[model samples]
Target: MLPARHAAPLQKGLLLALLLSLAACGGGGGGDSSSPADPGTTVPTPTPPSGLTPPSEADAQRFLSQATFGPTQANIDSLRTVGFKPWLASQFQAKGNLYSTGYSDAIHKAGLKDFCKQFSGFPNDYARNNCWREYYSAEPLSREFYRNALYGPDQLRQRAALALSQLFVVSNAEVEGTYGLREYQQMLADKAFGNFRDLLKSVTLSPVMGTYLNLVNNSKADPNENFARELLQLFSIGPCQLNADGTLPGGQCVATYDNNGVRDVAFALTGWTYPAGGVSPWGSSGWKNPTYLRGQMLAVAAEHDQTERKLPGGGTLAASRTPEQALDAVIDALYQHPNLPPFIGKQLIQHLVTSNPSPAYVARVSQAFVSGKAYDFGSGVRGDMQALFAAILLDPEARGDNKNSDPNYGRLREPAQYIAGMLRALNASSDGANFYWWWGNELGQIVFNANSVFNFYPPDYPLPGTDVVGPAFAIENANSTLARLNLATAMLYWGGLQAEDDRPGATGTQINGSNWLALADNPTLLVDSLDKVLVTGGLPANIKTGIVDAVGVWNEKNHGATWREERARSAVYLVLASPEYQVQR
Candidate 1:
């Protein structure tokens, strides 16, 4: 970008400097001077000026591990040297979308050209509609999703989109082949840090959501209450009437909206359908012979209901309202509802930080959502996702390592997250095709393949033997728990490739323990490194002893060629299976 004249001089200066350096080195000037290195690395474990100490590399790793898919050495080093806020700023600056910014190469590499082949041969509507699921949504796109989660720069956006996906609740299980689902998830990532109002509007119009919620092709005369009920009960506001701190009065939960409200809301949301032919601006001819989904659902004016629509605070929408105007009015009402800020804030906090945030924690995040640092919506808008998420992550309660007094502090590492964290931490090799999708199927929770609109689990799902909110516990039954343990064992020990029956010759994805093998001579250092990577220094003393003992036994048994591999593999498998790694505190 330099001007021609300036570029010529700069190039000359660079060449002159390079020649001088070469001559000086050859002349043996013996200059032992290395200019002071820039921080965030030079000082391997510097204390922060902010006075809140991360203290150790493991501590630093723990923070980033919680915030991201997994912590890399570089991330841990940076956080250890610079502390939390500066590292956060750098991460925020490196944001890019998973589905939008770069994915063509990944898709092409999967050998799925023309994934949407315009199939109309299947007898049933479900099969015919979902034939594309294998390539577009299931395999190829799943590869891209893996690529982004493992190596993408937009970690915060990916995490936020993940949280939003659970709330919005569109799944591949229902839609089959998932072209629209991909677009819908991308939209969530794109809008992850924008205004919540805009995010809700985009979700409302997404064809994937419309199809899943039965809102697309909806008419005023025969309205489907699915999307509308969820929009209030699940997506925006909670099921019950809530106070500012997201608490019910007198231990009693009251419904926020009755069936009548759902009916009215469905009436307002009607007459929107997918744009045909992978076209934008909606309602194009391509909708007849869909190539792939592109833009959101567009409204059909003739099918829209213009009857008096109910708004929050007993306000009624204009009787002659257009579809867009009516939808906008409803979104406005949802945004302004007193319950929305706290309701959404509580869930987001649960999603990102703690499963059981104190009312004070909810209140702080709620205030940020209600009165954001700035008004993001065009005019008179109140919610800002950027401010709200930052509040959730950086809140004092979220940041502190409080496990002694607060036993119900952290969330269980959900199946998808548990796999992702381990996969990323170890820098494992994956073709990004079969392993992730297979894992999703093996575990009950797939990334976008949650079976229904209620999501993989509810927020208030209770822990066994207690009334404590244990959301991930809902998925943890006897069989599923065994699956989690066995799957972790398979991935670390054998890389999820079944030896005899499941693809005997094909090794899907393998975890390389050559690096871990190098450190296996010393059990303390080996356990420490693995512990830091997997549990962030919180590996239980008993688990450590057991793994160390197991590795020692493996060394004794496999005194031959596989001892090194056995040592490393045993350590990873045992650590991952430990209760310490299962529930991330």
Candidate 2:
């Protein structure tokens, strides 16, 4: 028997807001400010390119693909009202106001300050306080490390998200802090829309990068090769061979670099270390101090390797590659390479939009990454975020021809999206850690806890002839599928609809249980709600029908019973479990 999976923690403030918002609409009788427009409610439809009164399904799909997680009735209506180009512009230049609900803000405010403060200790102090406990306990040091790293830190989420994003842009050395603290998360976010080269530099010095890549402890005599190896293989100048069109040549695979090249890069990476000691005449010890470092990576002179090194391709450089020199060489090497664009662009596209980007798609996006032609910045063409977004959304590959037809060319929904959507739909709170714990257990993917630097799964690991991507594919097997179904069932029936008292701290007070039933009683409305919150605004007819039928059956079976809420809940469960909802597009 396998262990039971769990759901993500719900936010109390969000749930309360949902309840109040719903009640203000007179018990779901009418649409409130947050309530999405009805699917059947007709308005003056726009004349799309085809001169059709309403936007084509492809247009709808494209809008959904680019704008939100997935399409929902509300999103579609907004698209219809605002038009695609305008909406695209807004999404590209999103402000804090884009989110109508305050859930994200609430989550951010919950304990971010405390989290940051806990990790703000001096590096030496931190090591002294917890290093012993970490060594003696059976629990892994990573757990304690993160606990200290993030506890009392209001910027935990932002820091984590930025680090995860940086895995895409920067070279390993720079990321490992061969650079300095110049590259923290806030700086990354602020400069996210700027030059790719700067972003790369920032990533290199980010404390997170230093800690994660082990650059903090890298020294002159024994330079750690982890950052050096990944720098070439994963970050830039990836595996061998390229097409004339600058794409990966057909049948060509990522080749391993000669050991000499690795050694040279490693040598270049030497000398950088976190600031140590207290903030005094000298700078604070880099992230390595672990006490006052606040988990940020910094360059430490003592730990840096100053040895001369030979390149794998037969070149020899003088001993002592300064951090700046190493960064310049590595960045230039990667920037000049033909493979960088396709390699990095492919990953970005997969993460942001789709998994199976076509070859043409890869070519176009890669071009933008290199030269920034389609969305390129000025002469010094670096990977600009605005350009990247344009390439992702406006590219011919992204707006596939299917949009004119069925418009189904989208990537699969990641587990994070699935869990978040369910929470929003259920209007539950993580008051007692129910939601977060549940999701961490069942989804096989957790926020801030990636299985490896490679991420939850590779975008194209399972080559046409290979089976290396087994773990990625297996996430959707029968057992996992059943778990998903069970999750949905629990949320709809026994999960969200239960009286507040049935939960850990409820005082048996029947607090607004009818909202759950009201949601179930109207299948169209229920599916529509899900469409808005979970799928964005693009529920297929088949999915809608299945949900309605499931809810109807459950409702009929339990009609006149006190547990009507459970029946309504069953409907939502069925909908979430559907294959249509599972796929991201």
Candidate 3:
């Protein structure tokens, strides 16, 4: 049930319209697993940095839907003008906004000092938890993420970083110190387009990741296997062996590494402590440093595991080898492992393009991951993210009408994507201070605060009563599905949140209803415009008609001077509430 305040905004008729739409498309009711495109059919390939244009506006919207936080009319126009390959090139060159260091560090420090001083006492300790939430926790970082995602020039970079964040899997829920968390995310954003090996090493040595996985104070005497186990099972390779195309070999779940191998890797990873600058709240330092998160985990030679160890995939660390040497060997073996390509590539595809990508699609992306360059990129570097993304986005399966035709080609829009997409499509603006955390909390995905290391939902999550996978749908339920409708009604019918006065530069979140209001008098035009902006192909005729008829009920004579506003709100509310808009094809 909605709080009394929100109840009034969602009128009964609108609720009925949404519920009817939900009955048709919600509940993760995915269609069969038929391929979106014929196995032999080839999409018109975009020549990178040159000849490529979206065949239609729907196609352009579809591409942006996959690659960005959400599509905007301006962005659509820009993409149409520059073409696909060129737009991707520009995004690759676009400067990234960093979260962890420099400016953000100053903000985090100030917020901590300011908020932590407000309350004094046990349990009512505002100094501890309050300060963390107000400034130093995932709250502040999540706000910045929305700002970048909503308006930053580097859309693809941010999106890639989000995907990488899930795979690398560090969260403020387990690891604290806002500075460290910000820096951790910054590293992911910075390297989102860089080599996979560099990213893997960075994740391995990161203080935030170190803290989350218990690697920070690790020593040969008490090495932690948490990081080692996840590095293989979650980050680098899966538990089962894959055939280069992401399919399990012989339809068998072969183990990638054993418990013994995990222990060996843990021993190899020992001898790391918090970075040097951290001072414990009690003023401790060195090996016992409090959780300082600003820099890479420091190496302590004396605590190193000097015994020989065999890496899981291949390679050996001889006795007397330095900690750095052993660490290098472990990373090298993992980076060169055959499992890295398809395991990482297929997941990337699921995140960016389709949920169940064809084996051929996975193989194509895997090949790109291995080569680390694309013909379009012309950069001869290995593990190139730019090349990999180009391969995924430009693939025929990601574009064309087949994406809509196939019953199983798309993914349910996760809460973040759904909210951001709606706001972006309706020309929304935000200081990004609160809606993300508030609404995201209500919807079960609060960014940097995922429920666990496994993430909000696993990549292989199967839709209910179906063989199809829709990872985002894992969080959807009776309550969340209704909450989605409630959120839409609030944004479209009522005004969105107002800016927080205490937050510097906060605009709160709001959409330009005027854009929709302008066409409200003509119900068909309003619905069509929304259909173009919000739905990926176009709204199904029945759904589109339902929204139009709902809007038409609010003619001026019957509904007074505010009729247009009512009609406009009804149209947007109904579209967002529909299952068609929930899935990103």
Name the top lDDT candidate: 3
Candidate no. 1 TM-score: 0.79
Q: Give the C-alpha lDDT of model 3.
A: 0.74
The predictions' CA RMSDs to the true structure, in order, are 16.3, 13.0, 5.0
Q: TM-scores, in order shown?
A: 0.79, 0.65, 0.89
- Candidate 1 segments whose C-alpha is farther than 4 A from its true place: 1-59, 100-136, 276-292, 374-381, 404-406, 435-437, 495-507, 554-558
Pairs clashing within candidate 1: 133-177, 276-286, 276-287, 277-286, 277-287
Instruction: List the candidate 2 regions with Cα displacement exceeding 4 Å.
Output: 1-72, 95-188, 244-247, 254-256, 276-321, 373-380, 400-408, 425-437, 463-479, 495-547, 554-558, 561-568
Candidate 3: segments with Cα more than 4 A from true spot? 1-54, 96-130, 281-286, 501-505
Error of 1 at 385 (Å): 1.3
lDDT of 2 by residue, 1-585 (tens): 011124423323533432232122111001011221221222221122422235544455554544343444445576667655555555444432110111111111222233223433324654345432222221222222222222212121222233344354322222222112222333554555566676666656554565567655566677788777777777766656554223443555546376668777876776665544323223224434532233334565556555666543234555555566666666666665666666667666665555555555566666666655453222336576556556655554454334312232444555555554454344434322222235444756543345466655655544233322222343444455455555555554343323333222322111122445666657667666655445445556765775666556654555555334544555455556554456544
Judged by whole-model lDDT over C-alpha atoms, candidate 1 comes out at 0.65
Better of 1 and 3 by lDDT: 3
Candidate 3 local lDDT, residue 423: 79
lDDT tens digits, residue span 369-415, model 3: 77766546625465778888888887766766545655566777888
lDDT of each: 0.65, 0.46, 0.74
Clashes of each: 5, 71, 3
lDDT accuracy of residue 129 in candidate 1? 50
